[model samples]
Target: MESRRRTFLRIATLELCERFGFYGLQSVSVLYFVRTMGLSEQGAIMLWGAFSALMFGVPVLGGWLGDRMLGARRTVAVALALLATGYTGLASGMGGAAGVSLVLAVLVCGGGIFKPNITSLLRHAFSDGDDRLDIVFTIYYMSINVGATIAALAIPFLAVHIGWQASFGVSAAVLWIGFAVSLTLPATAPPPAGGGDRRLWLLLGAGIGVAFTLLHYPALAKICIWIAAAAIVLIWIVLYRRAAPIWRAGLKLSFALQAEAILFFLFNQQIATSLTGFARDHLAGTIRLAGVDWAVQPGQFQSLNNLWIVIFAPCLAALYYHAERKGRPISVPIRFLFGFVLLTASFVLWRAAALAGAAGPISPWWMVAGYALFSLGELLIAALGLAVIARYAPPDGVGRLMGCFSVFGGLASYLGSLVATYGMAGSGTASTAGYTHLFGNLAALSAIVALASALFIPFARKMDAHWRHAIPRPSSTDKTPTEILP
Candidate 1:
């Protein structure tokens, strides 16, 4: 157990570094689009959304490669290297909009590959149905927030003081360090004993080729996303059909939770895109603390959610631990409902801030409060989301299912981006009325979902109880399963 903990720490540390690099670039990316590239608020938000979609969308392919060909550790290492290269290009600043787009596209692919495989590796390191997984993932997510907070605080300051290019350069350097660390980590999962068939390789190659081509054409890319998404749903349906009766109920619940997750991210994703626009247009230029004037940029405020996470994660984890020890543990559906309620509150707070700003540029404190709710929601939902995936996925399909889990984020990003684009369409600037209406609508949607999830909690609990009874518990001496991906 000590050895496992140490190995997990090593993997989590590397993940922290990778996230530092990823968020460093992401924190300031929308600002780059708006200020450096001279794009409209709508254009920047849409582009950010598209970039986010690709980041989440490519994971299924990455998971397939990791499980079938490269192995998890190998896949992660390759992705880190690619991310380094992409950040380096962004830092060089030689690229116009087109060049930046191409660089970001490469990053999207690398990020997609990196994200799921890391989660898969962590799951692989532990035994199936391990009780410690929840704590492990919570700690893991805390590391992510730690890295993200630092990036969010630093990148915007660097971009504003030095330049956007310099900020990106810092990210590139961090990613390279993570890549170096990755090279030394022990392999968690081995590839199949025999090499996969030639046809599988051909299919992967063809898929990559298609993705590359469509990236240049946004319309085609969106179409491809829908088509691929449909295919994924079909695959899920087939899996459900093939599952035995006991497994079928579990699978159904998994799909239900996943569908709910999409809704969660739909509202949660605004922090990267529309939220930035709101902060930029509405918040005061500076925050006065202890009679000291600190200028606040929209990019810098992106850290608020991470900051909140860092502050609250340990507390929340301890709360969960205490609850379970008391024999009154919180169930998944209850947690899901908590997350939705907090998320809904976040939008409501934002709506109130927008209304308040009609009189003057609102205080950044409003955004801070909103992000506090958002952060808690993220902890309840996204962190637990990983455990849910590991719990429900077949040992053989962990990587693939984790990849599919990322699809929820991808779909949310695409929908959020489209909504942000159309919602603020023809509104040249971020007007008070526009923000009020936007946030009002979002709040209402979140409220609806929260109530629905609450209503379904009883059903979910019943399903989960049956599912738990159906699975065989592992003994200490049992060998952990090695998934062989076809």
Candidate 2:
């Protein structure tokens, strides 16, 4: 196989631009829902949480289509078009209607398709497996930051001036470009699909699905409750063990990283969701600094995280690579633990910044500092997840495995919304004590997650070592004859 595909750079740049558009809107979505759309705290958080989760969730459906029927290119075109439409519609400030909610959901569905397949295509571009996988993901992650940085700089400024619609329109245009560029890239030979008899596979799939329904349907909650209980009681992840040792280990490590990444995304809702209240209650004055003016708005601060992501991602990636060159054990899960710990530190610092702001209008720089801290965490955890998923998945299961990671992302966002709700109740400028209390809880939670991850690392490393040989096998379904793809 040639070292790399000719089209890799083309795909990465376009995808990065695409990311900018999505995050541009996403960064400011909470603010839009509350301020312009007239949503309450409860309404905003729930919708935002659902939007975040569902956005990740829809990809499962998209992956099903991509792997089973539509193929990557077609699925991507359809999904990106849908995402573009969703952003444009949202830019209309039509967010107040039921149609808008459905539109948002459609965006979620579109994401399921567009997001995963882009990375899938990128990896598929290269003939090698896991060799350059980290770099591949890092490249993709960098694209996400490209958009993030641009969106960060633009959306808040746009939202402050022409309103959400115009800001959203800018994103819509970027998406189109992404779509056009993706189409222009060279195509690959679709790997011959390998599996058992189609008829038998279908029957088994249907039968098991039916059996699952029969087992879990009458009371869905009860089924999940028992499943969780079983996993906990067994002292090991039950459903997971059936997977081969390497995959099981890598997946565990991936989950730990994902848990950290998803939590960051979940907490990210606050920047857009609660910023209006935060700025309104605190911050002394606002003036026109850069053609746009917010008399007093914390929402402008949302851009700081993206800004830092844009500036620091390349640097951090280099640092990681540099460390790797020096024979460091910068394994994926270890990176996740550090990210989690840093995130905890960010909240702690945010509280201190809030306290210091009491004496005067806190420099928007404080939020920037906090965002910088979080963005560092993002680089380590969230950024690495997609690549990890691609590199480690059993060949036939790429889409499904990515879909699983997406589900975890959604679950984390959903849970984060709940956590954010409680934090917001006491997080504004209205009460100093409430604000202090808020960050304290956040720090505590971060600490706990970090601790859990540290404990999980040795196990992750052990599993990774054990499963080293089994990666990227051509067919997971061929039980007796394992054909490893290296």
| Predicted structure 2: lDDT | 0.63
TM-score per prediction, in order, is: 0.86, 0.74
| Residue-pair clashes per candidate | 0, 5
| Highest TM-score model number | 1
Q: After superposing candidate 1, which stretches have Cα over 4 Å from the reference?
A: 1-10, 35-39, 120-139, 186-212, 392-400, 425-428, 465-486
Q: What TM-score would you give candidate 1 relative to the actual structure? A: 0.86
Q: Residue 357, candidate 2: how far off, in angstroms?
A: 3.8
The list of candidate 2 runs beyond 4 A from truth reads 1-6, 93-95, 128-140, 187-238, 244-264, 274-281, 284-297, 383-401, 423-432, 455-486
Give the worst 10-residue stretch by lDDT in candidate 2. 210-219
Give the alpha carbon lDDT tens digit for every residue of 1-486 in model 2.
Answer: 343544777677767766776667666666566665566665566566666655665566655556665567666776677677767777666745354565665566667567767766776776556577667776666666666767766777787788777888888888777777767766554423555236424633443343233222324423443453344334325425656665776566555555566666665655655444455455555655677765544555666776777787778768866875776736766777898888888888878866875676655555667778887877677656666656555565555555555666666666666565654543222344455666677778888888988887777666656566556554766653311111
- Best lDDT among the predictions, by candidate number: 1
